[model samples]
Target: MVQEGLERLMDRIVLAYSGGLDTSVAIPWLAEKYGAEIVTVTMDLGQGKELDDARERALALGAVRAHVLDLRNEFARDFVLPALQAGAVYEQRYPLATALGRPLIARHLVEIARLENASVVAHGCGTEKGNDAIRIDLAVRALNPDLEVLEPLGVWDVTKQEKVAFAKKRGIPVPAGADSPYTTDVNLWGRSIEYGVLDDPWLEPPDDVYVLTRAPKDAPDLPAYVEIEFERGVPVAINGVTLSLVELISSLETIAGVHGVGRIDLLENRLGDTKSREIYEAPAGVLLHAAHNELQKYVTPRDLARLASEVGVRYADLVYNGDWYSHTREAMDALVAKVQERVTGAIRLKLFKGDHRVVGRTSPFGLYDQDRIAQSADTRPSLELRP
Candidate 1:
């Protein structure tokens, strides 16, 4: 029986399927209940080889047309870059890993629905109380109000054990469980780890929970120095090596993770009721965010820097709430873009023992002189001002 509050029927539905446990179950559930052709769309945001089997999995599970899009570059440029410039971090700890992907995925789902001439789009998001269901629904509605959004799990009262049972009953193959015992979401930008034993805030996250970053204690003895160059707020080059955005971030994640630079185990306040303890491995984000923030200070005026900081907090909130398409977010992005015009600079940082220390920074619009700052100490340099 189809759950209440989701009664619109259609000839076909485009599902934002990830080939995960939830989505695998959704394919059959949608077919059984809606009696509509299921078209699965998987946006591949650099989840590695795990995505190779998505098309096969979707077809085997009951999808008629399975679309797998390589959206890695789009994810980086469209979503991650703005957040990077705005210094958007939820709760001052999370860099909005899963939150960032929702809008982009919703956009694709809507486009697929249009091409397929399907009035309904479906997703395997968590129940009604889950945060992602809100994000997906809001995004789909905002993009195309003509289309109807369906969330099967949002009304289906099924526990995890029951869901597992349902998958088994449907003959859906389950991925082998890891010993880490945590739910994980990964993309080109970052990784999110939560649930299970991580719910206890007092208990530190175990080493096995982190795959992108090494333990701080396990980091190499020697300090690794890296130079990151930004052009109008977007990362462009690393150590004078000019690479595409995707390549630069991927290289940085590897380099910084090996030095134990990006690991955050913090209590996150979710969009829905209740707080969550989530562990994140965002090696590149950790390195780049620091460089970008420091570069802003070097280029922008003191007053503007303070205002930008405030705007950054608001930007984080807007993204956290999945209000990316809202007018307020557009205004926020305008301000962030204005600030970023002057945020071009190169920041040198030392990565060691799970921490990044800014070593030096240089910008064409620098507001201060290093030599003058060193000479005056606490006193303001009486140097002549030049435009």
Candidate 2:
């Protein structure tokens, strides 16, 4: 105990702060536990302008300094675009939005830790059963193994009620909706809701839990049609109007959400062979994936197409299992990029009542030979086989 206390006096910790109770409480707890000075890093990864207040909250909670970086553009270009082009949907369903965001956050956490010369970096992934802990830890270790990765919540091992009580006792301003049963994570790529009644896999997700998408039954009576254009596997336009990647995705999220597309409910296989009941709203991800996938069929040859699909599944697994910075993922990305060379095209999709389907596709590199494929039998040459 004497030696442990001595080590605490020299500690400086950098924490990933979200304007939430878990993180807010972590500030005081980490300082008290390690007798350390706290430096907080809050990232704006399409969460919104509200994250600005997180810095103030961190300071109020006894953090020595706070850094908030706007990483939305980098996230779209460096993370979302590559995952989309690679077709990285974990378990053939989730777009891996939450999973994708973790590594980027972890990368920055290490950067901030290095800048502060902190001995330890921490995050608020509270549950032992969840995957974010593994994701953040792996990314941190991969980037800079010398720094200690701290998970205060993991060590605290307290229930949500306990956490709330602890926050209140410490005079931490718990965010509004702190008592809400459902826990959610939101970003540009998607929004995920879990816990509360959602823990019952047999129960339907309450309508209140969803934000980005409307209920399928509540969607409009008339069907909607959209044209999405891609350049080398990246979505570049919507309905013939060119836009920035962020703008394109945001627009599609609204459009597809209005039509009640991209609501996913699944039993996700987390790391360590555990399972989780998860609900996700990813209007833009679903639409873009549908369009990009259909366009690939039109442009990619059969053998290469098959190979790309296989690589995509592996890529998805790697992302889900928290191997984002692995050399294997880099190699797979090279192949995915090679396959996407000809995936330049436009795909027309019909959307109605939570359903989206590809209606048509056109591409300069399309391999479909209409004359040969659509020819009648009489117009085609007959071949005879020897007996």
TM-score of each: 0.92, 0.94
lDDT of 2: 0.87
lDDT of 2 at 328: 97
List, residue by residue over 178-274, the lDDT tens digit for candidate 2: 8999888899999988889999998888889988998889999999999999998888888889999999989999999999999999998888767
Hey, what RMSD does candidate 1 come out at?
4.6
| Top model number, TM-score | 2
Candidate 2: the clashing residue pairs are none
Best by lDDT: 2
Question: Residue 358 of model 1: what lDDT?
Answer: 98
Error of 2 at 151 (Å): 0.3
lDDT for each candidate structure:
0.86, 0.87
**Tens digits of per-residue lDDT for model 1, 1-387:** 134656555689899888777788888888888788999999988765478888998999999999999999999999999998999988777788788999999999989998999988888776533787788888988999888888888766687678788888978887566223577788988898877778888887777888999888999999999999999998999999999999999999999999998899887788767787878988988888899999999999889999999988999888888888899988888999999998888999998888899999999989988888777786765678889
